[model samples]
Target: MKRLLNAIRDQFELTHNEAKSALLFFVIILVNLLLYYSYSAYTVNEQSEILIEDYGKTEIPESEERKSNWVDYGSSYKKSAKKVERFSFDPNVATNEQFERLGFPKYLAKTIINYRSKGGKFKYKEDLLKIYSMKPELYADIENLVSLPSKLDKKTPDFDEHRVIAEEKPAFAPKKTFTISKFDINTADTTQLMQIKGIGKVFASRIIKYRDILGGFHSIDQVGETYGLDPTVLPELKKYAVLNTKVKKIRINDLENFRHPYLRYNQVKVIVAYRKQHGNFRNTEDLKQIKILDEATISKIEPYLEF
Candidate 1:
C-alpha cells in the first residue's frame, strides 16, 4: 500500500500527503457505493417477497373476476342498442334538430351545420366523411340512409339532385354569403386567399407555399414574387393584402445550412465556411467581406440573417 501510494503521487504530480488523502477518499467512496448497492438489492428483494405473499393471501370476489374477463364485442355484449338511431336525411339540408333526432351529438350537429354555412356541400355520400369529427362507425350506420348519390358522375361538375325519390329529397336552403374584404397576407390561409376573384385554389396554395419558404412575407410586393401568380391579380391582391407579422429571421452563427429562398447553395456553403474561420457574423457588413456575395445578393438576404 505504501509503494502504491508513492507510485500514485509520482504519476499524478502530487505530494505524498495529498496522494494519501486522495487514496483514503477514493476507498471511502468505493465502500459507500458497495454498501448502497447491497442495501438497494436487499430492500428490493424484501419488497418483492412481501408483495408476492400479500398477493397470494388476497382473494378477488367472483363477480369482479367475471366482470374483468367480459369484453364488449360491438353491439352484442352491450346491455342495450347504441343510442344512435338510423334515419334518411340530407346532410346539406338537414336541420340541427333533425341531426339530433338521428342521435348525432350537439357539437357534431353544429359542426355539420357550420360546414354548410361556409358553402361546403355534400355532393356524394363519401363527402360526409370530410365533416370534422365525423366517425367512421357513425357514417357506416347511416351509409345507405343519406339522400344523396354514392358516387358522382365523372364528366359533370355537379351531380344530378333527382337521384333520390322526389318526396324524400329535402328542399335546398339558400347558402350563406362569406366574404373577406381584407386579411393579413402573412396569416391568411388557403381558404381565405381563394376568396379573391382571380386567386383560385392553385394560386392560393402557391402563395402560401412561397410564403412559408420565405418565412412569411415582409412586403406586399413579396406576394407578387410567388411563382405562376398572374400579374392581373396583383391589383386585387394589393387592395386586400396586409403584412402585419414580422419576418422570421435565421441565426447566421448556428445554422448548418441556409434555407432562405434568396440564398443559393454556393452562397450558403461560403457563408458557413466563413463563419467557421472568422467566427459569428456581426451584421450584413461582415457578410459583404465574402467576394462572391455581391451588394445585390447581400442586400436581398440581409433581412433574413441574424448575427
Candidate 2:
C-alpha cells in the first residue's frame, strides 16, 4: 500500500501531504456518487408504492361498481315512489282518487278526470279501450270490474195483451183500396195541393209561387221544375196533377221578358239585341239562332213561350 501510494505520488509529482489531500478529495466524490444513487433508487420505490395505493383507492372494476350503484338507486327509488293500489272502478263516473287507487298513473288519472268533466261519456266497458294511454295489461286486469253497460237494451212495449186487443178491435175491419184524384196544376191553391199525400205546406207554397212566376204550367212536368221540390215526389205529382195548355205569354219585345227564370242575363241580352237587329220572335224555334241559347234550353222554354 505504501509502494502504490508512492507510485501515484511520483506520477502526479506530489509530496505526501498534497497527495493525501488529493486522495481525500477523490474519496469524498466517490462517497457522494454512492449516496446520490442510493437516494434516487429509494425515491423511485417510494413513488411506485404511492401510485399503487392511489390507484387502488380511486379505480374499481366497472361491473362491480355498476352493481353497487344500481342497488343504491333502487333503494332511493322505492323510498320516493308512490305505492299503487288495485280496486274496482267505473271509468265514466269514478273520481280521480278512485282512478289512482285502481293502479292508474297520475297523468292517466288526470286525463280521465278531464275527459269526464268535458261531457265525454263511456257508454260501454269496451269504450275504455279508446284511451290511447291505457296499457293492455292494465286494462285486462280491471276490465271485469268496470261497471258500465255493454250495449243499449232493446225496448219492449208494456201493453196488457187483453186490454190492447179489446181496445184495438174496431167496429168493422175497413176494406183496403187505393184511388187518387187528379187536379189542375195551374189553378190549385196551397191548401188544395197540400191534400196530396207527399205535398206538404212548404212544397205547396213553392208550387204556387213557381206557377205564378211561369204565368201557368204548360205541362205537369213543370211542377218538377219548382225550386226545393223533391225529385222523388215528381212522379207522384205528375200522376195527380195536370197542366192546362191555356197559359199566359210574354211578348219578346217587353222588358218583363228579362224576368223569366229560363232567360239568364247573357241570354236576355242576346235576345234583346237579336230582336232589335231583327223583328219580333215569330216562334220559339227562332230562339235557337241566338248563340247563347243551346238546343236543350230552347226546348225547355218552348212550352212557356207563345210566339
Number of the predicted model whose lDDT against the real structure is largest: 1
Look at candidate 2 and tell me the lDDT of residue 3. 77
Question: Compared with the true structure, what per-residue lDDT tens digits does model 1 show for residues 60-118?
Answer: 66797789976443332122234556778999899998886776666678899999998
- The C-alpha local distance difference test score for the whole of candidate 1 amounts to 0.80
- Tens-digit per-residue lDDT, 1-307, candidate 2: 5776556555554556666777778889999999999999999999989998877656546897677755343333334335656666778778978876666666667877788888977866777877757667667767778887654442654354224654665677688675667778889988778766557777788889988887888887788787645566677777778765467776666654456777687787888889888878888767878889999888877766755
Off by over 4 Å in 1: 1-179
Scored by lDDT, model 2 comes in at 0.72
Question: How big is the positional error of residue 123 in model 1, measured in Å on the Cα after superposition?
Answer: 48
Candidate 2 pairs with clashing backbones = none
